[model samples]
Structures are given as C-alpha cells and as structure tokens.
Target: MTGTFKKIRRRVWLILNILVVFWMLAGVLCMQVPPSEFWPAGFVALSLPGALVLNFLFLLYWVFRRSWLLVLPLAALLLGWNYYGRLLAINFAEEVPKEAKTLQVLSFNTHVFNAYDKIVEGVPQVSNDMVDWVATHPADVFCLQEFYSRVNSIEYNNFNRIGTRYGKYKFVSTLETDRIKANLGIVIFSKYPILQGGTIHFLNKQRESANRAAWADLDVNGDTVRIYAVHLQSMSIKSEDIENTYSAIGNEESFKKEGRNVARRLKRGFIARAQQVEQLLEHVRQSPYPAIVCGDFNDIPFSYTYQELAEELENAFVKAGNGVGATYNGPLPFLRIDNQFYSPGLRAVSFETHYEMGLSDHFPISATYVLEPKAAE
Candidate 1:
C-alpha cells in the first residue's frame, strides 16, 4: 500500500508539470488571434482551465501528455498578448494633439432625471431636469444618452423654449415605445449648424432595450466634425446571482468553487462590453471627418471597453483634468463613467466633473477641445 501511494504521488507531479507547460503553450497560440476576434478567442482562452481540469482527472491515460516542444511557441504567445495591449495603449494616445479653438462638449447619462432609484423603477421624468441641465451647459456641443422628453409634443410644448434656443439640435430615440420614458434614447445639441444627424441601434439579442449610438455632422469654422454619442450595456451584477454563488457563501470549499464562477461571469461581461466597443471601432474606421465620441460607457479606464474604444481617440480628462475623474454618482466616487474622445487634430484644453450638481446620480462631464483646422483634413 505504501509503495502504490508513492507511485500515485509521483504521477500527479508529472501530470501537473505537463499541464502547466501545455497551458503556457496554449497561451502562446492564443496570442496569435487579434482583439477583434476576442469573442471566440477569449471564450476559448478563458475556458482552457476547465478543459485542462477534466484532462487532469484522466491523468492515468497516456493521451494526457503535453508536448514539451511547444514551450517556445507558448512563450511567444505570452509576449504577443503583452505587445498587443501596449500597442492599443499607444494608439489611444496617438490622436491627442499637444496644442489647437477648443470645442467644448458635455455628455451625461442624466439617469433620465429620475436618479438611481428612478432608473431601478424603469420610470423617468419627461424633460424638466434634462432641459435644466442642457440650458445651463456652456458647451459648444452637447450629447446625452438616456434623454427623455414627452412634454414637448405640440400639446404641452414644455421643452419648446429649451429646444428653440439651440441653433441645431437632435433628439433621437432607439425605442419608439411610449411605455417607458428613458428606454433607448440619445440627444445632441450644437451651437454650430448641424448639417445632418442619424441614430444607430445595436443588434439587440434580447430585443428588450436599445443599446444605441447617435451622431451629428457639425459645420465648425468651415469644417465638418462628426460627433458620436454611445451608451453601452449596464454592468450591474444581479444580487440573486451573487447569492447563488459559492464565493458569496463564505465557506472554504464552496468559496473556491463559486469564487471562480463569479469571476468568470464578470470576465464574460467585460468581453461582451469589448464586443460592443468593436461596433464603434467599425464606425470610427469608416468616418470621413474628424470625430468626437462622448457619453457614459458604463466602463472604467483600465477596462477593455475603455481601452479598445480609446485606441485611436484622446480621452479628454487624461489631458486636462486633475485627480481621479469619477462620474457615476454612487457610494464610490472613483467611477468615471462619463468620457469624451476626439481625433488627433483636437487638443483638450480643460476637463471638469460637475460634482457639485446634485440633480442626477451621474455628474455631468465637460471638456473644451481645440481643433486644428489645417490638420483636421
């Protein structure tokens, strides 16, 4: 019995060594795929451990052996992923100019003027608070997602006064249903003449709510600059989902089992966000004019969504704002959900977070951008 136990222990060690080496090689092969293919690539990359665990259970089989020769390939893959991330970071900073009439733009989720509790209830105000915020802004152009307005339907004419003030403004709704006030919508107001504008809603998998984009062609100083407003999916994890997980249970055995599952779900959400970002990337790639993308992305700086969307655009706050630019008005003040991105011809002179404003859960974010007309073309 002692001799048999010793042999089993030796076999386990050998299996672990082979598995580790195989994982290293798999990581290398994974690096060959681009971030654009991150969905399929990421799914496989993320599921490897589970697959390997099963393989480890069958360790007595000779088929479980790993190819040690793939070590070099695995190393190459690790370096490739690292390099890809670095390249993306570099691209994000490439469009920001050292110096250029700064165009000021503001983007706020506005929580539909109903705040967090209001959003939770799925009911929001028509246009009173949003009109107030819009009226007070000093921005050359303003973009807002989750904009709600049912008051100015010719009968009420509540938002007429506010709407008439702007030279050119657009209010686009992804969902036309009158049932929910702030379902899927976006609004853009500009002091400059708006030549044209349109809305693009994402491929709705659930067909429940709209994840959308709105854009406007603004004629500024005889040049056309396109502005895009985006609001991706919510990253909120359900409380019930958390409770069902073993990690949340706080037991040693269950903790290890459920902790990884919770993390995996979070990672899946991040990957989904990245996929949504890929849509914006396609739009940006096709853009003919210098562009500005501003809105609440439901993401943070270090996230894949932020990093990918920012690949060729300059983040306004990083250039001009001081401190941790948090925008989501929650218990945590470090959430910078609101953001503004512009092309390389634009210079971010200043960026501010209106923390003093208590009207909405999200603090309105504003930035003054200078566009080099000569370089814009």
Candidate 2:
C-alpha cells in the first residue's frame, strides 16, 4: 500500500511539473507571436509570472528530493531569461548628474479624474489629489491618458490648471466623445517648445473606446525628442465580471456565460492591441528624431504589444526600475501594465513608479532621461 501511494504521488508531481514547464515556455514564445495569429497565446502570457512562481516551487521540491526532474523547471527558466527583467528587476536607482542635459517625463492614466466614483471624506479625493500633484510636479513633459476636461466650465479645468500651475507650457491633445461641453481623451503638456505635434487616429474607434495616440516633438534646447502618449485597447472586463469569474454552486450556467463574455473581451483586446501597436510602431519608424513612448498599454509585459515596442525601444522600467514595479491598482494585482519606452540613444537616469498615489486604478510612472547634445547643426 505504501509503494502504491508513492507511485501515485510521483505521477502527480511528474504531471504537474510537465504542465508548469509547458505553460512557462508558451509564455516565453508567445511574445514573438501576435494574438491575431493565435489568440490563446495572450491568455497564456497573462499568467506567466504566477506560472514562474509555481515552477520555482516545483524546482525546489525536485531538488530536495534529489530527483533529476529538477532539470525541467531549470531549463524553462533559462529559456525565458530574456523576459526576467521585464517582469522583475533588482537594480538600484540611478543618479542624475548636476548640469547634465535631462528631460523628465511623467505618464499616467487618471481614470477620468475619478468623476464617476464617490469621493471619500478625509481619504483624499483621488481626482483632486492627482490634479494637485500633477500641477506641482517638476516634470518637464507630461503625457496623460484617459484625460478628462470640461471645456466651458471652471469645474473641470484640468488643462488650464496644470498648464498654468507649472510654468509656461504648450499643449497638444486628442479629445473625443464630447458631451455637456466636456471631453475625455489624451493630452501632453510641455514646458519646452513643441516643434510639431498631432494625433494618431486609430482605424477602429467605436469598439469600447479604443484610444488614439498623441505625439509631440519637443525642442529640448536644440534637440527634438518626439513623445508618443498612447492608451491602447482595454480588455473591457468590468468589476462585476471579475467578481463572477467563478460562478456560485447551482449557477454553473450563469458562470459559464460570464466566462465566455470575459474570454471574448480578452480575445478582442489582444487582437485589437496587436493591430494598434503595429500602427503606432509605423509612426515611430517615420520619426526623424529620437522618440519617447509612454502611457497605459493596457497589456501585460509579456504580451505581443510590449515585445514589439521593446524591439524598437528600451523600456525605462527594465532599464532602471526596481522589484516588480507594478503600476496597476486594482482587484487583480501585480500587473505592470503601464510602461515608459524610449529610444536607445537616451539613457534612463531615473525611473519611479508612484504606487503610493492610490488616486487612480493605475499608478503614475515618471522617468528622467539624459541625452548627448547634438552637434551644432
């Protein structure tokens, strides 16, 4: 009986080990394949960090047992090593040299300035808090996503307040779905002069408020740095859908319906983001000056969208951030969805994720870049 129990346990471990390794490998390889080609790859990449944790546990178990199966998890990790920094980093913060040419850019999604949520007493109205914080921030350039404003009233004068509060600033914006003399959109404010700027109109906009990219070419002294502030396709998964992820007993049918609904949204987001990123990348390719891309990507670090961007530019967090550097604040935690990607010519001297500002569903991230001045042209 003891021998039979040992055999059953061994088989279970073996099966689990094999499954974990497969999932991890799938996530590693999926970054190169677009979800438009294989949609399931996006879902697989979503659980990659958790899958990595499980694989580590299995590795330890195998090592303690003096089993050769330790090779499974070990091989999977080595193969996925390229993505290690994207998911986790332990580098110390970098220091900006005094008098060095530096450009500070802050990117955030303000959740429409907490307009629809109840304002809690004494807990800091996130909308007011974010607005005030941004106004006083020292960043030379600000790229805001899901930016809200009331054009005709002083009630929601975020644009005028932030622009004037800081200093002399120029603005470029892409406002959509205006109603009641207000608008929801993306914008960029810069203390430096903007040489040129405009919006990248997405081909598909009606499905779930697919956002557009706002670009501004700012003249930092004599160098022109193009900044692209983008908010990609959202998964459209609501709070209730997250709550009903697992149906109650005797409501299996309802649960299944919700499951299908969530899956459909997820698949749609994956494909749409792939299409959007391709379009955004083409714009980057046409950029005559060095580019800085930042905003709420709405996709994970291991997705096709990030991979494509990383191939063209360096991720600021991976270059300078410490630990997980998670920016999303929501029920599903530990998601590093927001990012700052920049051209290789620029160095990320400092990177910070302002997780303490619990004002929005996503935390604000700022990065300071140092670049060599161009020769007198």
Candidate 3:
C-alpha cells in the first residue's frame, strides 16, 4: 500500500513538472507566431512570466530532492535565454552623460487628463495637478497619448498650456472630438522644428478606437529623427467589468461568466494589437531617419506585439532601466506594458518609469537617447 501511494505521488509530480516546462516553452517560442494566426499563443504569453517563476521554483525543489528533474528546468531556461536575457538590466547609469548629444523623450498616456473629473462640482478638478506637472516638467520631445483638451476652457486647455512651456512645433492627431470641443487624441510636442508629421493608419478597420499612433519628423541639431508616439489598440477593460469582479469572487458560476467576458476582450485586444504592430513595424523599417517609439503598448514583453517590435528596435528599459519594469499602476500585477524602443542608429543612455505619478492608470516613462555617429548622419 505504501509503494502504491509513492508511485501515485511520483506520477502526479512528474505530470505537473512536464506541464510547467511545456507552458514555459510555448510562451517563449509560440509568441513569435502572430496572434492573428494562432490566438492561443497570446493567452500563453500573458502567463509566461508567471510560468517562468513556477519553473524556477520547480528547479529548486528538484535540486533539494536530488532528482534528475532539475535538468528540464535548466534546459528550458537556456533555450529561452534571449527572452529571459531582456528581463534583467546590467546598466547602472541613471542619467545621461553631460557630454553626450542627447535627446530627452517623454511618453505618457494622460487618461484623458482627468478632464471629466471635478473637484468642487463647480470649479476645475484634479486635472489641474497634471496640467501643472506638464507645464513645469521639461523634455525635448513629449509624446502624449490620450491627450485631452477642452478647447474653450482656460483651466483644462492643455493644447495651449503645453505649447506655452517649450514646444512651438507640434502635431495633434484626433481620435475623437465632440460638440463641446472636448478633444481626445495622441500628440507630439517637440522643442525642435517639426519638418513633417502624420498619423499611422492601421489597415485593419476592426482595431479602430480612441487609441491611435502618431509620428513626427523633427530637425534635431541638423539631424532628422522620427518620434512615434503610440497608444496601440486598447484592451478596453471596462469599469462595469471591474465592478463585477468582486461579486464574481466566491461564486463559481459568476466567476466563470465574468472571466469569459474579460478573456474575450483580451483576445480581441491581442489580435488587434498584432495587426497594428505589424503595420507600424513596416513603417519603422522604411523610416528615412533614426526612429524612437514610445507610449503604452498595452501588452507585456512576452506578447507578440512587443516581440514584433523588439525584433526591429532596442528596448530602452532593457538597456538602461534599473529594476522591475512594470508600468501599469492599476489592479493588474507587474504589467510592463509601457515602453520605449529605438532604431539601431540610436541608443538609450538612460531610462526611467515615472511610477510616482498617480494621475493615470499607466505610469509615464522617459528615456534619453543619443544617436550613434557611425549609424546616423
């Protein structure tokens, strides 16, 4: 009876171990395939980092047990070393060298600048704080997504406030604007002269939303650099969905129903983002100048959206970020969705995630990039 029980336990342990390895590999290799072609890979990607942690724990367990199973986890990690390699940063410099010819770029999603929120029901709301922050803070190029403005109001008129600070050259692409002249869009504000600018239109119509990506060609010290401010297809996780979460918990049927709704939104988001990334990647490849991509990707590093861009650009955080790259500040745990990526001609000297800002659901991120003389004119 003791021997039989030992056999049963061993079988369960082996099966669990194999499942972990399978999931780890799928998340690494399968993510390379477009989510449009196989949507399951997108779900696997969402679980990748967690699976990695589980695999590490499994390895430690095997080592302590003096079992041969340790080989599986070690081999899995080695196989996906490139993806894992990006998780850690060895760079220690937090600021760019004063001697370096640097372009300071800041990207943020302002969450509609909280224009809809009111303070005293009659006066201006907390958005004044964000407006004050932007007016005082300085950056050479500021790429803002979900940028909102009430064209008539003096208090929330960020369109003028931002330009008043530093940027005379600007480009604004509207995703939505209503009768009250309340504008919501993506914008590029540059201290440098904007030679040209335009919105990147994704071919897939299904992905259309208030989220959009825009770019600008700026004359930076006689060099033309393209800055892409992207707010890719939003996950659109609704407030009602969030409210239903607490009610769903502890009720098995309710939980499944709520889970399905959220899952559907995520799946839709994954496929749409993959489409957008493909289009943007082709545009980046054809760019005539060194390009810098910044904003809310709304997908993790393990995702197809990120993988597609990472293939063509150097991720700023992976290059110079100090630790824990998660930029989303909502209910989700450790989601590093906001990012900065640069063309080969440029390298990030320093990068920072502005987690201190609580004005929005997503944290703002900035990076100082220097054009490599040999790679860019």
Candidate 4:
C-alpha cells in the first residue's frame, strides 16, 4: 500500500513538471513572436507572468525535493532574462548628475481629467485637482493621452488653463474624436519652442473613437528633439468584463462568454496597435533630430507593440526604474501600459511612476534624460 502511494505521488509530480515545461515554452514563444492581426500573439504573451511564477515555484519545489529538475526552470529564466528585465529592474541608488543638460518629461492618461464625472455630478473637484497638480509638478515636457478640452463650454477651458499655467511653455494637441462642443485628444506641453508639429490619424474599423499619434519638433536649447505622443487602440474593456472575470469561477458559461469578449477585444487592439506602430516607427526613422516617444501604449511590455518599439529605442524604465514599474490603475493591476522611450542620442538618467495621484486610471510616468552631444549629431 505504501509503495502504491509513493508511485501515485511520483506520477503527479511528473505530470506537474510536464505542465510547467509546456507553459515555459509558451512564454518563450510569446517573447519571440511579433503580435499581428493575422497571427494574434497576445494570449501567449498574457500567459507570461503566470508562467514565470510557476517556473519559480517549480524551481523551489525541485530544490526542496533534492531533484536535478531544478535546472529546468533555472534555464528557462536565464533564457527570458530580457523580458524579465523589462518587467523589473534594480538600479542600486543611481542618481542624476546635477550638471548634466537634462530634460524632464511626464507622460499621463488623464481619463479626460474626470470631465465625465464633473458633467454628471455637478462637481469639478477632480479636474481642479489635476489642473493644480499640473501647475505644481514642473516637468519640461508633458505628453498627455485622453486629454479633454472645450472651445465653447461655458464652465471650463482645461486646454487654456494648462497652457497658461506655465508662462514659458507652449502646447499642441489633436482631437481623437469629432465632438464639436468639446475636444477629446492627446496633447503636448513643452518649455522649449515647438518648431513643427502634427498628428497621424489611425484607421479605425469600428469607428467608435479616433486614435492618433502626435509629434512635435522642440528646440531644446541648441538641439532639436522630436517627441511623439501616442495613444494606441484601447482594449475597449467595459466594467462588465471586469466583474465577469472576477466572478467567472462558479459559472462556466458566463465565464466563457466574458473570456471570449475580453480575448476578442485584446486581439483587435493588438492588431490595430501593430499597424499604428508600423506607421509611427517609419515616422520616427525619418526624423532628423533625436526622438523621444512617450504615451499610453494600451499594451503590455511583453506584447509585440513593445517589442517593435524597443527594437528602435531605449525603454527609460528598463534603464533607470525599479520594481515592477506598473503604470495602470485598474482591475488588472500589473499592467504597465504607459512608457517612455528615447533615441540613442539621449541617456535616461532617472525614471519613475507617480502612483500617489488618483485623478486618472493611469499613474503618471516621468523620466529625466541628458543629451549625448556626439550621438545627437
């Protein structure tokens, strides 16, 4: 009887080990594949965090069991070091040099600065708080996504308020929607003079809301730096999806339906973002000056959108940030959809995500960079 029990335990362990290996392989494949509309790779990419955790658990299990299988998860982790680094970093007390010619940039998605809530509740407290925060947090440049402004509204003009807050700064924006009474778009406010700026409109199939990539050529002292502020295709996740995902355990049918809906949205977003990134990359390559890309990518670090962008630029978070560096404030807490990427000509000195501000669904990310004169030329 004891021998039979031991046999059953060994078989169970073997089965679990095989499952871990399969998941690890899937995670590795996700890292290698470029997510496209035709071949959607986000489902595999989404499995990565769980795979990593499972691998770590396996490593510990094998270690305690005194088994040679410990090497399997160890090897898997070593292979995906690049992906791990992007998810977390340990900078070891690195500090920015005081004398360096630095530029501070803040990227945020303000969820229309709570304008909807204000319109519904007859209270503008959240918008007022955000405006006050912007007035105090003195960044050299601000790349804002889901920005809202009104040209003819009787109550408030957020655009003018933000632009006029800093006496030395100039601002530019492009609407992502065609609302005549209000402007819903992305915006860039810079302390430096903007030489030229424009918007790249993306092709939307559903035509619900327009998404765009906006660029500005800023003369930063003696050097020209091109900045691209992009708001990619959103997943279109509704509150119902979140509730369904959480309550999915008991009812299989409802769970499956919600799962399908969520997956469909993710797949669509992944495809749309891929097309948008291709266009944005071409625009970046053609720029004569050093480029700094900042915005809410609406995708994860492990997705194809990030991989394509990372191939051309340095991720500021990986260069200078610490911890998981999550920027999204939602039901899915681990998502880091907001990012800052810079050309080789600039060195990211410090990168941070401000979580204290609760005005929006996205926590603001900021990075300070110094120009490398030789590389700039």
- Put down candidate 1 lDDT per residue, 1-377, tens digits, no spaces: 99999678757765665665576446435534433446454444443434333333433333334535334334433444432232122213234455435678888876655533443355443445555666667788878777655542542232343456454465555455455332336778777888988776555343533667788888886878899988876665444455666235657777677766656665555555666777777887788888988887876554556656666787777766766677887654466767888886677777788887766767888887777767334
CA RMSD (A), model 2: 3.5
Order of candidate numbers by TM-score, starting with the best: 3, 4, 2, 1
Q: Per-candidate TM vs. native?
A: 0.64, 0.89, 0.90, 0.90
Q: Per-residue lDDT for 1-377 in model 3, tens only? A: 99999778867877888898888877888779888889988998878887787877888887887888789888877777767656655678755566667798998888877766653645434377776776566688889888887778776678788875454578998744655667788888888999999998775665455556899999988888999999888887966787797678999999999999999999989988998898888888889999999999988898999988888888999888877777887776677889999997788888888877878888888888887676344
Task: Give me the runs in candidate 1 sitting further than 4 Å from their true place.
Answer: 1-100, 115-130, 151-161, 165-168, 180-184, 204-209, 238-265, 375-377
- Candidate 2, residue 249: how far the Cα is off, in Å: 6.6
Model 4, 18-91: lDDT tens digits are 78778767766775575664445677876777777777787788899888877877787788777778777877
- How far does residue 163 in candidate 2 sit from its true spot (Å)? 0.4
Question: If the candidates were sorted by their lDDT against the true structure, best first, what order would they fall in?
Answer: 2, 3, 4, 1
lDDT by residue (tens digit), candidate 2, 235-310: 7887678877754435888877888888999999998898889989999999988899999998988889999999
Q: What is the lDDT of residue 334 in candidate 3?
A: 72
Indicate the TM-score of model 1.
0.64
Better of 2 and 4 by TM-score: 4
1 or 3: which has the higher TM-score?
A: 3
Model-by-model lDDT, in order? 0.63, 0.83, 0.82, 0.80
